[model samples]
Target: MEFLLTVLASAVGGVAAGLIVARLTRGNMTGGLLGGMIGAMAAHFTLYPSGEQALPGLLVATLQGAVGGAALGLAAGFMMKKKT
Candidate 1:
């Protein structure tokens, strides 16, 4: 249950980050979305150990996920941008 919640939070964070990055960079939304998801999940797992449960922990994880998502989304958006 907690794991699922973490994933869901991470995904939501990722989507928000992806959309923001896409809009800002005028880049590929698909790439940003995928990158955000992957980065969020990676950060969540890397930062939090299993069996931890708390409101603060969840909030921190979500923030971490968002930061990770934003970073990867930005990278992906730039890489996928078409040269003008």
Candidate 2:
């Protein structure tokens, strides 16, 4: 189903965002994960279109989610309060 595919795509996007954030932030696992979740949630709400076919929609959602998630994660990284 398109819904499931959308979730999967969002998860993949989250994981990718997490990894990238972790690497960029010198291995902040918790920050990366939380950022990824926020990013995924953002993509889920923002990108998924209704009544789409399975494969193409999945592909589109994945790409959109990936980009959106990364951008959001990056922004969050900058915006989040630093713990000193």
List of clashing residue pairs for candidate 2: none
Task: Please report the TM-score between candidate 2 and the true structure.
Answer: 0.64
Tens digit per residue, CA lDDT, model 1, 3-59:
778777877787688768877888788878888888888777776655455323566
Candidate 2 least-lDDT 10 residues: 47-56
Give each model a TM-score.
Answer: 0.81, 0.64
Error of 1 at 55 (Å): 8.8
RMSD of 1: 2.2
lDDT of 2: 0.65
Q: Return the top candidate by TM-score.
A: 1
After TM-score superposition, the amount by which residue 19's alpha carbon in candidate 2 deviates from its true location, in angstroms, is 2.2
**In order, what lDDT does every prediction score?**
0.77, 0.65
